[model samples]
Target: MHLRKLIPFIGLVGLCCACVFAQQPAATGLVDAARGRVAIPDPTKPPPLTNSVNDDQRRPRNYDMQPPTIPHRVDGYQIDKNFNKCMDCHARDKSAFTLAVPVSPTHYIDRDGKALQQISTRRYFCLQCHFAQEPVQPIVGNGFENVDALAKKAADASQAGKK
Candidate 1:
C-alpha cells in the first residue's frame, strides 16, 4: 500500500536527521601533534632535504647484532631487481680491489640454514637493514642506552652493593 512506501520514506528522513544531529563539532585546539601547529586544512611546507653523511668512516655499533650503517652517501645508486650498485664495491671478490668492506659471509646463507655461493635473495636488499646518517637534529630526543653501557652500570651497582 501507499502507507508502506510512506513509512520507509519517513524512516529514511529520520535516519538522515539523526546522523546530521549526532555529529559533534571538532574541539578547539584539537590539532595533530605530529603536524606541529599546522592547521588540519592548511598544507605544510616540507623541510629541505639534508645531505647524507659521506665521510666513509665506519661508526661503532650501539649493540650486539646491530647491522653496520652505510658510511658513504648512496644518492642515485641503482638498486632495482636487475642491478645492485652496492655489490660492485662490497661483494666478496670486489671488496679487495675497491677497498670497501665486503658484505658479510652470513649474507650468503639461505633462510633454510644452507649456504649459497652468492648473497641470498632474502639479504640482497641493503637499505632494508642499514641506513646512512645525516647531520640533522632528531625530531624527538633519544635516551637509548646501549647494551654494553647498561651491563657496565649493572656491574658497578653490584660491586657497590657487595662493599
Candidate 2:
C-alpha cells in the first residue's frame, strides 16, 4: 500500500522535471538578428577621436533662458575642484583685460540667494551649462522650431488679414 502511493508521487515529480528540461524552439527574427551583431567593441584598442573644427561663430539663442554656447574650443582646459580655466578670461575683473565676456552676475549668487565675491560653488563648473559649439551633422532628425519663428508666422498672418 505504501509503495503504491509513493510510486504515483515519484511519477508526478518526474513528469514536472521532464517538462522543465523540455527544449523549446529558439526565439526568431529580431532576437536572432541582434545576436548576429557584436555587442561590444574590443577594449584593447582606443576609439578614434574626431576633431571638430572650431567655427567661433556665435549662434543666436533660440530662447532668452538658454545659456550661451562656448565660442571656442576648450580642449585641455583644467576645471578641477582647485581651478577653473574659464575664469581666467571670463571673471569680472579679468574680462576687461582679456576682452572675454564676464561671467553672468547670477553666477555669484548662492543657493540661499546670498551674493558672493567669487563664483558660487553651484555655478563654478562652466561646462555644466556651456558647451563648445561645433558644426556637425545631426545624428537624428528633428522638426523643432523656436518661439520667435512661431511669433513671426502669427504676425504675418495678422498682416495678411488686414490687407
Error of 2 at 88 (Å): 0.8
Q: Write the per-residue lDDT of candidate 1 for residues 1-163, one digit (tens) a residue.
A: 6887799889999999877654422434444445666655788886887999999899999987899998899988898889999898899999889999999889999999899998899889889998889877777668999988999999999999999
The CA lDDT of each predicted structure is: 0.85, 0.78
Question: Candidate 1, overall lDDT?
Answer: 0.85
Name the 10 consecutive residues with the lowest summed lDDT in model 1.
Answer: 24-33
**Candidate 1 RMSD computed on C-alpha atoms after optimal superposition onto the true structure:** 8.4
Give the clashing residue pairs of candidate 1, or none.
none
Model 2 TM-score relative to the real fold: 0.68
- Candidate 2: misplaced stretches above 4 Å? 1-49
* RMSD of candidates 1 onward, in order: 8.4, 11.1
Models 1 onward score TM values of: 0.74, 0.68
